[model samples]
Target: MAKLIRSIVVSAPSGTGKSTICRRLLAACPDIKFSVSLTSRTPRPNEINGKDYHFISHEDFQRRIDEGEFVEWVENYGQFYGTSVKVINDALNHGKDLLLDIEPRGAKAIKKQFPDAVFVFVLPPSPDELLKRLKKRGHESEEAIKIRFSQSNSELKEVLWYDYTIFNEDLETAVFQMISIYHAEKCKTNRLCGKIDRVFKI
Candidate 1:
């Protein structure tokens, strides 16, 4: 039998450096594949279709929802975003671990469908540091920054439901931590059941 593929779901508030950490993790782990999400929102200037996100119309998004195509989905900032069940299962069936970058709400939804998935929550070193990072980004207005900062507080509460939490204070340290978790999980007894059975047979 082929080895079982694991899914890693990562969640973090805006400006928490989750994207940077995830990018590093993917570069370091060749066996892992990033799961691109479908979004009703328009692509940003540097965003590529089917790369950053699969941009679609509101009607199409709703149609997919009706068709039960998504494993999990949520509406944020007046736009819809979701992960397709087929996309996830297909990668896992091919023996590829999947890395999912989602918000707290969508993460919760995914947990319901895939209880065995590894849930990781990323956080800034401190609230003050989080504020600094948001401001340093220079992409949002003052009011928007304030709003995001406030939302981060509630998002932090969801960390309690996660399997692991990583403080993204230093990019290198954070990436190392994630890689460690990946390696540890791959060696877990439950994840190695197939190999264990074969060993016994031998």
Candidate 2:
């Protein structure tokens, strides 16, 4: 079977540990490339432009949008972020798997634009666990924590639309499950021809 590039979009609540799992998954599979979103938000102290995000000005971001350059764009937390259509097409054309840790709104947009993309929904074991994790971050103020918790119910409601739901109760276990899901996807006939050919040599 010829290599078929896969794109996976991950959606989860802010403190569900999806980012950590994604980092480990990248380390485990070097062929997979994580897509960095372009944003109008100001970069944090440690964030490097083009690495963490494109970090463009609002005017530039709007210009790109008007030019029809982005595959998916969404506004969140009073900032705009987008993924480039060109980059995603290039990655898939070369048989490289790409992953994007996108928000739910962006995930919906991407799914509409690219129906072949897989959607993974990560969830906390319980609301208490989510509260604990969010608090442990120590960066959010009490008001912000309360806001996140308030949004959790609405976010979890969207899980039903996803292809797969992963409970991030145990970090190691969840990571392995995600890896397994990707491996399983690679075997589908619609996704890969090499696997089918190898199984039946006529």
Candidate 3:
């Protein structure tokens, strides 16, 4: 099948299985490219600077913000995260399918520009379950987890407007749902109209 250039924006609160789901989805559909975000925060021990995120100095991040090089940016936990305008533009311009793993703020910004893009919200089994998962992650302090758990309610509210929501109760099932979503999006009539024309309409 001819793959149509598409954009997938997946957003979820911290500690949710959004990252894991995205990883599995990418592994299953290796052709789709992931849009690495830019962050002013220090990289975690296992994360690679260019792959996980474009880690940069606060001063440089501020300069880029001043230059309007980002499509959107949001500050969380005393650090900044952003999506590059050039990165996304080049992908769509070159007919590449792109997956963006970002927070709701960045996802909303992308939606304004790419109205046709599919926006998915990943959810934990429940709010209480999410809090437990966050605590278990051990990536943040107790105070930070409290703040994030509180903000999670607001993030969850964004799901009201999202195209789909995947309840990540089971890892394997969730990955399958994510992959199914991507394939279904690829087959959407609007997305495949041109590609179909070349294959059969002629």
Of the candidates shown, which would achieve the greatest lDDT relative to the real structure? Answer: 1
Per-residue lDDT of 41 in model 3: 98
Error of 1 at 42 (Å): 2.2
TM-score for each of the candidates: 0.93, 0.89, 0.94
lDDT of each: 0.90, 0.86, 0.89
Residue-level lDDT for 176 in candidate 3 = 93
Q: Compared to the true structure, candidate 1 yields what TM-score?
A: 0.93
Cα-based lDDT at residue 16, candidate 2: 98
Summarize candidate 2's per-residue lDDT along 1-202 as a digit string, tens digits: 4455468899998899998898888888877888988999898667799876889999999999999999889877678989998878877777789999888888999888778888999999999999999999887699988888888778888999999999999999999988987877777667656666677762
| Predicted candidate 3 versus true structure: per-residue lDDT over 17-66, tens digit per residue | 89999989888897688999999999887999889899999999999999
lDDT of 1 by residue, 78-144 (tens): 8899999988988888789899999999999988878899999999999999999999988779998
Candidate 1 — worst ten consecutive residues by lDDT sum?
1-10
TM-score of 3: 0.94
Q: Which residue pairs show backbone clashes in model 2? A: 1-193, 1-194
Candidates 2 and 3, the one with greater TM-score: 3
lDDT winner between candidates 2 and 3:
3
Model 2, which residues run further than 4 Å from truth? 1-5, 194-202
Q: Report the C-alpha displacement of residue 157, candidate 2, in angstroms.
A: 1.0
